[model samples]
Target: MTGWTEYTLALVAFTASHFVPRIGDLRGRLIGRVGRRAYFSVYGLLSLALLVWVIVAAGRAPFVEVWPQAPWMRWAPNLLMPLAAVLIVNGIGIAQPFTLGGRRQAVFDPADPGFAAISRHPLFLALALWSLAHLVPNGDLAHVILFGLFAALALAAIPIFDARAQAHFGPDTAPAFFRATGLFSLAPLANRSWRKRNGGRLVKRTAIGIILWAALLLGHTAVIGVSPLP
Candidate 1:
């Protein structure tokens, strides 16, 4: 299929994946109408199907250069990928209470340190970073569309998810969530705080980052049939 055809299909899948979650808000009514488990099962399956379709479409689409590739940008992804990976790992390891997906506790504790001090949604931020890093290097019609859509989704979802969380959890929870996890979303500004929390763990984050960088460098050519560094 043509890149345009693939792009269109990807857009549809992406839109469905994002918009489907919003319907969960109607749970009370929907669950009342349909069985609760049935509603969730259907929604989960639909979301999974859409996600798989988008990934498949993205993989099939050929890269069509939209702009001149810069030598510097080639190096940038190599640098950023590691940071993105660390954020991803931190998100996985940390028990951030502020994020919609983070673990919820009965009591709030300020001393609860983790990736929360860096960003409320480190995982989401990592995804955004990874998308941006790849988009910069790919700078092609298909990649531009795919990564651009992903970047926009990652960014837009944060606020939307935060709002939904506040609505569901109450106004009091929003402030703490914002305070704890907001920093991770913006790395440069959170450096001081991240250093304090991570301290000796910075070495661990760096090691994880290097592993991620190497994995991407090695895998990009095989997976995409193009060496991003070259």
Candidate 2:
């Protein structure tokens, strides 16, 4: 239970930072007053700061072994994080009205839904993947609690966000949007039609994802005090 108080407080603060902004029209009103870029920038910094506190506090907390360290476990994040990074890079600043990264651009044609056709909630999926991947290597109780909640929350947010999208677009329009995209479908990736339309953009984003993955992998030990290498 050592340092548990700080860990718990940091976790609560981090969680509240996200949900508080979205309560009723708080986020909308904040954006109205402070502009979208400023609002997100401040929110992002606050979230990042709280996240760092949570991680540091977890490190200071009592270590209770849930599973013994295995050389093989380290490979999970190494293998999965690149895909997660790809999802993250592609998901950011997209025009998919059905997901978190939507509201950035003004245009989103359900007909040519781009990446949304493959996964409507790529960012959420990426978060789930990243958290789960880390959980494989981090078998301590504190790390488990930290990453487990993150994995659960990210997975839960997908359907919640989708429902919010439906509410926003209304019954008449939501069905068509749902028909055009999928929550977790990979069919679009294999489809010739989607490939013809979004292949170039996908390739470009994948390259960026690879670069991001490399940067994180190289920076992990310096930033987090552990190498991600298996």
Candidate 3:
């Protein structure tokens, strides 16, 4: 496709992915209309399809390198991506009260000490970091625009979603919710909470994240067919 076509497609996909959830309490409405299981299935399928299209289109778009990356920015991904991975793993593995599992009282308690000190939304933070890191290295118009859009969405969606969540759940419930998942919201307080809860499990996840980061750094050329380090 032409550059304009590629840019348009990328923008459309990114905007749809970010803005769809904000449409008229669509998430709750979907759950109420189709039931949880069916809603999740449909949502997941549509998201996956959009993601696949974005990836394929990104690969086909002609890359016009905008500028030479600084040494620091090029290397920053090595550090940030690993941290991002750790956050993602911890968010998935930890039974925090802000998560669906923890919220339902399935695995952890709301008043648990660990859950009380950590941000509930580590996964979103992880994704945000990954997007930001890539935005630094990928200087092409399409790449910058696409990754930049994700970074903006990840940052913006946190507070908007948090407010909506608090409204739906309750004002009294906000503290625990914030404590459990505030990291995802881009609040300084949440970062402090996350640091306080940095335990052995978090360290182990960091180690795993390091390994994943190394793999990505070494394999970026092959997987993405571009030498990021160059």
Candidate 4:
């Protein structure tokens, strides 16, 4: 249907919008033109607009079934969602040199790297979890496109981040950072208790995550007109 076409366009636009801007000097040039703060402000607003369009278009697209919804499907998010949220909260809450403007903060420890004890790229991990958690139960063409794209991009980012780190931090610091961090679930390497070091932030962010997830549970029907709860 016509909505399928719209959904496809929206998906393509969403991917291109984020990627194209950052390809070369385009983003830097834009930042120079508009000033960094204004550029980010505009970028944020534009990205939000694109996201809304994708969601709206996906909602309207005629359902093209893939697999029949499994009875056990809803449980996937229930189990993994909190972990994803926690990772994201812990990841971004710290100053990660990989993120935009974060290198300026100089918070990435060659020794610890905070939650990088679990994974060097916790934000990417969180995103992949979030994408896959929602995508599996979705089982529709439009949503498959949307969430699959995100999951692929997030997973791909892990390696990309590593490469960027090596380049940016140089041969010495980067190698030590990589040695300290694990590609996945390196909690075994954690030298001390993370809970002790960042207990307050952990409690606060997890509580906020719970509140947000609860709101999504209650309001998914209202917002998307589909009950996430089976």
Candidate 5:
């Protein structure tokens, strides 16, 4: 198959793996039939396979440069990646867990929102920032498409999930959960409530994030064959 064709299939599989199971009664049906553990096992492996395929195919695809390599822009990834990692850790918890185990947000009171007051969809922000961080530095056609698709998906998921939440939890409830939250700055940093609420957690998270960032910095060359540190 052609590089474009392989890339297209990889992209489709990645997107479908995320959506097809959750959007409809499909997830329930599978769980009922196979049991949640088995279903999750199958689903997890499939998703991982598709993700690996995407990475491999994207790397192998025709490298048409979209922009001249600017090593100066390497700083962007360094900054953005750590921030992205932090957001990812914070995002997939409390109200919005990304994994199958934390799928149900019903037990968790949405009213308290916690970190979600920063952004209704921190995972989306993480994914988008992660994509953009790499997208800018890579400067190749396949990578541009790969990261661009992910960023677009991340952006699209915000409103889509919001609308779904409204439909699931009633119109008033969804809006209420997001009262102080936003896509970016629905909750301003200057707000005393925001500062008071997130302060301690932010400090702890920063410590963890720095460790993660350092590992990434040191591992970048070994993993991606590129040096991200200055």
Candidate 6:
């Protein structure tokens, strides 16, 4: 198959991998059979593999320029990625069960909602940020298609996840969860109620985010064959 064909297939497979399991009780049935740990391990590996394929295929696809590359384009990812890294650092394995990356065993406290207070779907927001930032620099048909799908999916997932959570938690408990969380907002940082609760964890996560951002910037050329620096 041609590069574009491969890229298309990879994108379809990646999308399906995320959506198919959510159809009816397929995910629950799989978890029942293999146990949650094994099911998620396999699912994670598959998703990672598909994501790498889509990325590589996009590079291989014919570069049809949609817009001229500019030095300013490179600044988008550089500026946004640190925030994305921090969101990933804090959102992963967190107690918020309202969205993706929440730990099943952890209990979510509505009063002290932590990062969820800033965004209930922090990981998805991070994914959207990463996608949009990269999209600004690429300015090519293949990569535009690639990053556009991711950005759209990440944004769309927030409401879908919220609806699902509301359904799962029912009318009583869902109000408190919804009240404490925002879809994506920086106003929480300025708000005294949320500011007092987030405290040390925010600092710790930001430190980790800075380290991760530095590592990614350093490795960008090695991994992607292009320097992220403008």
**How well does model 4 score by local distance difference test?**
0.76
Residue 62 of model 4 has an lDDT of: 93
Candidate 4 pairs with clashing backbones: none
For model 3, residues 166-224, the per-residue Cα lDDT tens digits are 77558776666555544534343345544555555656766887787778878988877
- Report every candidate's CA lDDT: 0.69, 0.88, 0.65, 0.76, 0.74, 0.90
Q: 53-135 in candidate 1: lDDT tens per residue? A: 76667767776779978888887677777788777766664575445346645243445555566666776787788888888
- Measured on C-alpha atoms, candidate 6 has an lDDT of 0.90
Alpha-carbon lDDT of model 3: 0.65
State each candidate's clash count.
7, 0, 5, 0, 0, 0
Q: After superposition, how far is residue 203 of candidate 4 from its true place, in Å?
A: 2.6
Residue 41 shift from truth in candidate 5, angstroms: 4.3
- Looking at model 5, the pairs that clash are none
Per residue, candidate 6 scores C-alpha lDDT tens digits across 89-194 of 9888877876889887767788887888877888999999999999999999999999999999999988888898889779999999888888777877887877
Candidate 1 positional error at 215, Å: 2.2
lDDT of 2 by residue, 1-230 (tens): 54988888888998898888778989999999999899988988888889889999999888899999899999999999998999999898767865777765646688898888878888999999999999988999999999999999999988898888789779988888889888777788788989999999999999999999999999999999998898
Judged by lDDT relative to the true structure, which candidate is superior, 1 or 6? Answer: 6
In terms of TM-score, which candidate is stronger, 4 or 6?
Answer: 6
Query: What is the descending lDDT order?
Result: 6, 2, 4, 5, 1, 3
Candidate 6 residues lying further than 4 Å off, grouped into runs, are: 187-197
By summed lDDT, the worst window of 10 consecutive residues in model 2 runs over: 97-106
What is the TM-score of each predicted model, taking all chains together?
Answer: 0.71, 0.91, 0.71, 0.87, 0.82, 0.93
Top candidate (TM-score): 6
Output the lDDT of residue 13, model 4: 91
